[model samples]
Target chain A: MMFYIHKAACISPQQTFGDIDIEQLHVAVDNKLYAIEPKYPHFNGNALRRMSKSTRMGAGAALPLLADNDKPNGIIIGTQVSGMEENGKFLNQIIEYNEDMLTPGSFVQGTPNTISSQIALINNNKNYNLTHVHRGLAFENAALDAAMLVNENPAHTYLLGGVDEISANNYTLDTLGGWFKKEPCPSDGLYNSTTAGSLSGEGATMFTVSGNQAGAIAKLSAITTIHSSDVAVVKERIKNFISKELPDGKKIDLLLTGENGDARVFPFYQACEEILDDQTAIARFKHMSGEYPTASSFALWLACNFVGGILNIPRHMIKRHGDLKSLKNILVYNTHKVGQHGCMLVNVA
Target chain B: MDRIVVTGIGVISAIGHSVNENHAALVMGKTGIIKGGGNFPSRYSGLLPFGEVLVSTDELKTKLNVTQPGVTRTTLLALHAFKEAIADAGLSPDELSAHDTALVGATTVGGMCLTDELYANTHGDTENVEYVRSFDYASVNLFIQNRYNITGVVNTMNTACSSSANAIMYGCRLIKNGLASRVIVGGADSLAKFTVNGFNALRILSDEACTPFDQNRKGLNLGEGAAFLVLEKESDATGKKNYACVSGYGNANDAYHPSSLSPEGDGPYLAMKSALESAGLNPADIDFINAHGTGTENNDEVESRAMLNLFGTLPNFASTKGFTGHTLGAASAIEAVYSVLNIDRQELYPNLNFSEPIADIRLQPVMDHRSAAITHVMSNSFGFGGNCTSLVFSKP
Candidate 1:
């Protein structure tokens, strides 16, 4: 389907809320990389205070794209655990209050669709609104749906987003599950090192995808996901996806991957890297955005910048810098876990 | 466009354990709401009525042969319904694991069914935190996908009560767009203290059974269970036992309140209108309607206004929530199965406990278990965050 991304907004661990800050990059000194939230002007005093961090970040990122642009007919937000921290607090309050007369503040905020619904509530755009909460491919699924919606009615526009927050307690518990490094690791060290657990990060990335090519920054060429853990099966699928998405002579300028320095799952990224063109420049984003399920959205934002020539390869992010005068087709391959894999191709306008 | 049809269906609700059992309960006019469930001990357990499943989590685990630890009741309930749905569709392991078979599941309080475990885990102790992995919003679907080795796009939706309806909608899109040939779609949410207490905190839980559309209805009764439907292209389902054709679906947001629908029911109105438009059918052609009647005063009145605004004179309509209570994410799938049964069986279930209709807009519902010329059945599911969805199922 014809899917073109017009605008992008992100709230991540780095200073990437309203715009991409390429001058300097922030590294996570601790294992958990918290999202650097921007002030939400759409929500007033109590409304902002009541919303969860994920919701605030999601609205803070999504509302700006809708401010001075074509209003989208739909909104789809994706997240692995949007209101997780609120759920934890709500449960704790239930215990403290003895399940008695408790207000609906925390309980209502505990729902996972808080972000998408809050965006709808903020903009008062009563269009098609939905939320996807898959483990790793949540953002990809949302984008796929957005593509379908746009194809159905090319005249209409849609807003898509991915958001997840860092729950301190949950991050610590995740270390027990071997999802986070036992000790704090620097951004550069976590990108290339062979560590058991990777860094845990959270972010909210929002953009407008429309069939209207006017003022488009990049075309969402295609999105594919592989649901396998077997090495051969995943490798075959990766190769097939490259050929299917790229085809003949469509060389990739930049290849961004979700490599968070985990030894067990790094092979999946390697399988993807092995199939890329020899001259393709390599880039990674987990060191900056950490290892959240929807972290691919961050990688996608970075790929969009490279496509628009808004950014050059950072020293710490570049593995093999290619000599490309103008970046064109950028591919983002994110294998969040050993079993889950996602690939997307962004064609510059 | 290739027509998407439901080849198989499965359900696990308070009223029944399987499709046949649930159908039997509907025919016999048996209500599943009871004073309290013996399991999950809470202040309202013995006081307020809830449509809790009869099967215990341990029993479900043993019956389903689930050896995986930390598998919450939500996942177990999903496993029960998913097994039945795929089996009813006569899909083999090879077919299930095929590259074109996608699974779309939805849940609201997914893994939070073990609220105590989550609370303890979220506290300081890391020792007994097995459910830490289960806390993912997509935990139920991921567990099912891994257990069944589903290779296609397996996604999970969590748009409050409208979750599974969107899931079914997305599954059909996957087929029409040539992404997946077959899509397994449904949702599951077992009763959780977090949910029950949350709803209770919202003051929307009724002390008595939920009497949808009734003037005297207080609120809704929280329910628990799971339901799934296997959808495939018409060519792929040619020789299969087809239930109903998934004709059309629509989703919209009210943009009014976080948990309440607009006074005019704009979201529900647009959702139903768009569904009809997509199905190439007029509002008058929708013969039966399965309303998202949570028995809440606001919902019944608002839904009545929306339906009246859409179809001047409403057709045979009822809210099966009276029998199943509010299943939240699973409510759509469970009601979708009921919608299929309404089309295939040519009958309509009465809205239980409903006596007098609402005062201003007195929209009478199907109050008796009787046969009807059920052709196009519309199922409505509206949830928190103003997310509303409608799915139309027609007789095959």
Candidate 2:
């Protein structure tokens, strides 16, 4: 196996294992959904006091939840807005200081890779580390890299993850760009909604992926990202890939969709719905994650949990078909309204 | 094991645009470091010299032959260097796409130069909403992918100064593992007040010319540039021109400081050791070393000590920071290009302005440029967040 996710942690708009269970997640009618306020001091207190909002929460998720003896292979983080919150603060200081002087702390932490680096600092991990940023495919690209690392060198137990937060200023910019939906999907049924924008959610999810299969959560089967002008081509590619990989139509057991109540990008999700029959139970995660470039990471985390039989589909998600049996194969498809698409496959033990 | 070889190299740094220009300047001990040109308030900047590019944006655009790139100066530099590298490899557009080619780019500034300018102009005016779209690091790589029509494993790695080294290392792995037949790997960075002020706030800017491994070394001088290399698998490289063969590489985090390196140089020490081990060679096999040697008070001394510990006696080693200054994200890739040049020309560039030694062990670098029968060169690039990467290239 190239990659095996041993443990996964996430902090999103939903209750992501810190404050409460999945049933207690917040319900929002507006497309904007913020992560439940994370308790940073629970992981690293001093860092909690020093770090900015995104950095603290991002670093917190990378901390191991299960294993305490085994050191992680390394840390890899994916982010679209690295330290934009701190960057905005630094810019504000520059303006307030009249170009005379400003605190370098915010500027130092403002880099896109600062979160990953800070995680390394906290964990004291000197192993192979990387930070990848590609708008919609940021986490997929990062996940793919982590998988390759485990494949190339089995000595590594990688932490592959992604984090994205909505800054006040940048969120407004997204609002102007039509990325954030005006109204959020109801908590009772997220997938049934007909809305213009996605629930704006922010989250950070990390998994300990290793090549060793002993006590592994799930095995990464394959991953492919395409930037195409036509959705039909994407469907064709997916069909062709599945045909070549599976001869007897082994069939995916679960299909994870990144439908965030946005009607425009639902066609890709519909394509997934059309390709697979009732054997594959369809699920949507954008209701919990909201919509971010790397929000597919959240879907991937949920997929792995579902495959491991550790998580049951939340009532808010769209469940098109099939009862949760021995979950085996999961295929996730995510696309932004502006045409960034990602597809990934996860296989359970 | 399949070997990965550098078949072509291109760079646009402070010294020159093309490989030949930079090589000539290095041999002649020329410094690209110059005083600021009133781009900002000079008083606040301490009159520190920087390695600003000589070519204009329009000139670079014309050279790259891009009509509507919709990118900033950083992407233009990357495109120019990438085209030269591809052409130098003698690969046509059809060959590039036919072969499994991956594009790995690194940049710290991204499109901040243009975005900053636009943001400065549009302080509060929401009329120009286009600038907001430019606030991303993926745009540069996406543009390159589109321009070259490369369709495999296109990604970007940003690890501060060691960004491109990370990119190059990833490309090397791609070829070694039979993932890609060929890979274009390197880094790009452009001048921007955002990065400059960021570094300045850390108080690491040097007023005088940077002096690597010197007792009185001050700090690094910021620069802007880009460089790239076409790496092909050994099996696929038959009958094809080879710039230099990649022998080995290693990446280690200091786990010491977020910005500063470990006082003991543990990261560099492990990185160099791992690289040598990966190459299946000893430190004695290295003919020359391109030290990270950023000339900062902390870096130069620590790197020198790391050298002394690794080789016992330093070989022909020098810091090209004097010629190109420190190009941040582009430093490692630019130095990779320099390594290929060294192996091909059998030359060792001088470490300009290195009059005195810093470390008590007193490792002396090749103070003046010299030409020899170069066989292998080891290059080091360490960056913020304790990222340390080392690359070893050999004559093809």
Candidate 3:
């Protein structure tokens, strides 16, 4: 079953939230990338005043997909760290007060499903709502779920997205754990570095999906996850998916690979590269968006924009340029924790 | 669409370590909730009651032969239940490692079971990074994926208390969609200062054992556990011992409140109504209901009202949370196992710690273990985010 991405929006560290101007991509702060946000004036209420950075970004991204006051049949979200900033605030409150004087304010909004609930609350929608929290497969799973749900009732629409945040507590611990580069790593030279750690970043990307193809930017052709640490096993999975999805030997015009600049885990990207023909253009987003669990969502946003003919492959994103004929099909390939790999294909609607 | 059936089930909870053990305890009307939780040294250690698992982390690690680093208590409990489930299904190694075999796990806290260590790290009081790998909620299922080498579309659901019920629903969808022939789905959550303090701050955690659906019910008792059910296509599960058929599922959002259901119980009513529609059954077809019944002031009344609104009269309904406490992410899965057991055995387990009927609803629950001509069983789980889900399991 095929589902169309009718309307898509993204709030990221880049200028992609609007019709992105490639010249004004966001730069990192000490290798920590943060999403550029808006005033979110539409969210006006006391309840929304308590929205966290992640929830605000999520709702902001998803709000544009829906017409004013129009609610989808479901809102399924995916995130590795939603409401984490609230969590840290609550925990710090407990520690500072010695677990004595703490309110449920922050704790109440700190669940992994808080983003989905906040969106539902704002719209007053009471249809199916779910949140998937996997390492990197979060968005892919949510997308597939949306597809299945839409297939169940093609007349119904669904809103699902991936949103995550990089809190100081998490970033500090992650940096201490060697997940981020020790020194400043700018977006320009992200993949060129020969370092053990990858750059850290966070953002939110959402879409209003439906079985109908009207006013659609792109069709989500396929989405899957390959969970393994072995390069050979991962390579086999990618190779099989490539062959199956592109059975007629049609080359992907643009392949957005989630290649974080970590030299230690570069071989997995190489494995993905091995499956594609040299004629296929290869571009990685981590160089522009940085690396997070749901970075592939940014890749999806890119794929939709490309197929929608919003822009050409930006010079900054071009790693291995090929004949830029037309944007027919694009693939998003990303790895998480250097073990879990995720892939999604977007075709022109 | 293919029919999804439960081939095997496994669970590890505060009441027992395995499915059979839990069933035995249910038959004996034994409760796992204690006056104080001994697992953690939180401020509420002795002040509030908890359904803490009886087993120790080290003992569980040794028992499960899990030597991996960064494996949190949540993962340990999940692995313990996962082992029992696959074994009960009599799945061979080849079948487990097959491409069509998938796993969907649920958890609210993955590696944050060490809430104190996380706090210590945040304050620069400790230089330890061992808990870093477990910080992502996906770590719970990541450990499982690595252990079982499950390559199929593995995902984790974290919709608060309704997490595993959604996972179970997602598993059935996978089978029906021809994505996978089998999916192992469940959830795990262990008591930690993180959750304990969070709930304590909410002021909804009870000081004594929870009494669900009672007039004087104080609140819910926090619990810990894990449960896994092997959901497979009916053709593939034909030769296996089928426990129950995953007939229908429905998920809805309350939207009225983040942590409280609407006074009208719109979410709960829609969920149950959609589930019955999905199952192609009428209200009379549902023989029993494993209600969400958290014993919280808002939940019990609203859930009861929803039942009355939908069925006009209650079925054989009970909240097993009185026995296992609210396990958060794991509650729905554990209760799902109990629901399937209710149909498979043609018997209903009693709801513990119940005395008087709810004042407003004036409805009584199944208070004694009794045999009945059970057929279809409905299981409900509502989460903190107003995410409500209902699942219907029927005789296979």
Candidate 4:
């Protein structure tokens, strides 16, 4: 009894939806990353101008498909930085005024719950709403919450989403924090560069989750989280949870990884790859989407599309030689530097 | 199915910093609203009196033996609230092994106060990198985890005003699912320019002492506070004194407006109804309600109407915000702690500043604290993004 994904949309570093043009997306190099330019004007005009990056990305990705469904019973948006740009700008204003004065917009955007708040405002479909942040696991935690909610109430559609953006000051600070790779690499050939840190990027992905199997694009068989510093325990738990929760004897067809340029995290993925080996097609996305807490959302998004029969994997994301044509079941694994781990099982319907 | 019960409660609002002080204030009907301090506007911002705690970080440190600095106001409040909760539960540190106790928290701003200060101190001050770590929720988790050596699942939830409610809900779920044995579920937040300006930008901050349910209720006064409750499964509570039973809880989104609730109050309505249904009790079983009543025009009317629609006639209801102002992430936890207090004492806390009734409904909030044999308390917390939640605590 797995929850199914009815409709999924993503505003990422690639052309995700609405006349998705594969060629138009800006590719990157070893140290550079960028957000895919979706038509914001199409979703909203003046409103788009007013939104912080996270708000705009979430609304653009969710509103198109979400508008057609009857008000969702619950809405949950996840983000690592709710409104970084607005916060920075507002602080800039304060610095200019010497802390004597500041405006409300900066503070409004800084609340961390602003993106979900905006989404709720637009849909007017308030039933249950939540905004979860766990540094890098923000999106996974949100998806897990949505799946659990769907399990509790089988009839309603729950929206699980994640959004964040690159800000000048924030990005600069990230670079100082040893977050991004210093060298550059082509977007399609990100892994070939052998870099250390990932380029900064931003995105939003929304999924319509339901318990019903009929008309489901794909079923989410299982989702699990781990917070252990011991890589051995992390590896064992992944194998244990997946084997226990998913149908046995079905080797995964695809493996979606949150493998940023960081070499330290490769051991965990290496452990995973050794388990399935050639049975699963390997793919990594931090080169395209950059590394953020909720970047796992993009991996899940790509898995959903693959399950939905898109059959197209971004050229820059391939990490191993496996036939994509035979993809049926996809396993997405992601981790943060602080040792938060998450895994989700996606199936072809 | 397992039942979730509240075994311990702790709070630090404007009235007092401990459970005893808060109970005394509630019973005596003493208000905590006062003029703002430091850079905050004292009385001119249409200030409704708030139930604000009267302690600075220095005072908190002196009392709690905390040595950390450059932390956010939110963390300070959280430490105070959690210490009381653990003590009230009689959960001695020596009684359990490390990782047996888990810390689950919710906050709108993890360390915005520190962030604000850092931004101001552009003079190249080499402050501890560990202090800035509080800028995110994990930092808060790390703080408590390291202090108590809690190795269990440590997580944070942020969904506007409903953040802590979700934290509480998740804590209960984790225990129900057998993920952990003992968990601290609650949140803490303090007033900062970020939130004060944010609410002001939305035109929701009250210019005077807030009057929730009043016909002229304009908006809510921002407040500072923290609250926590120890949720233990029945098996874990074999030797413990329980405060209240976590009868039911539900969360819903209005999907209406991000900043304002639905005009019909459908989200709040459904959340309350669902919570009632989950508890296997009818609305009539509710003896009192701790309303979210932020004194905002939209919240009071919509929440009041939703309550009226659910219960027909409003039960004994009041907004503690009229006393403490709104504590944002900590609001629900503060109110939850208050609800436990009222039930434990068999008394009802008054909704201060409630003078006139709104035209939308005939419901009136208790203007003065009342004493009665209370059994069940329904608490509501609605936040931006149409995030609404209702929690029911039944007397043990």
Candidate with the greatest lDDT versus the true structure? 1
Candidate 1 or 3, higher lDDT?
A: 1
State the C-alpha lDDT per candidate.
0.87, 0.78, 0.87, 0.76
TM-score, one value per model: 0.98, 0.94, 0.98, 0.89
Off by over 4 Å in 4: A21-25, A29-32, A98-103, A182-196, A271-281, A322-325, B36-52, B58-70, B90-103, B118-132, B145-153, B175-182, B202-208, B215-218, B356-363
Candidates in order: C-alpha RMSD to true structure: 1.4, 2.6, 1.4, 3.6
Each candidate's interface RMSD (Å, one decimal) is 1.4, 2.6, 1.3, 3.4
The residue-level lDDT of candidate 4 at B118 comes to 43
Per-residue lDDT over B1-396 for candidate 3, one digit per residue giving the tens place of the 0 to 100 score: 667888889999988999999999998889998865567667777888889898788998899888767789999999999999999998888888899998998998778778777887777754576777687789898888888888787999899889999999999888888888899999999987778788887888888889999999999999999999998888877688988999999899999887889999998999899999999999999999999999899999999999999999778899999889899989999999999999889999998888999766789899999899889999999888889999999998
For model 4 the local lDDT of residue A66 reads 68
TM-score of chain A of each: 0.95, 0.91, 0.96, 0.92
Q: A262, model 4: CA deviation in Å?
A: 2.3
Write the residue-wise lDDT of candidate 4 on A1-349 in tens digits.
3588988898877777676754354666435556775777655566776688888888788887666555777777778767888877776665566444455666666667777777776776556777887677688778877777777789878888987787765565555445666665555555554656566788888888899888888888887777766778788888887788767677788889887757667678788777676746898877667777788888888888778876477665677867666777889998876477888888876
- Model 4 CA lDDT for position B87: 86
CA error at residue B356 for candidate 2, angstroms: 0.9
lDDT tens string, model 2, B167-285?
A: 99989887766667889999999876667777788888888888888888888888889999999888887988888899999888888877889888988888888899888889899
Worst 10 residues of 2 chain B by lDDT: B37-46
Q: Model 1 misses residue B95 by how many Å?
A: 1.6
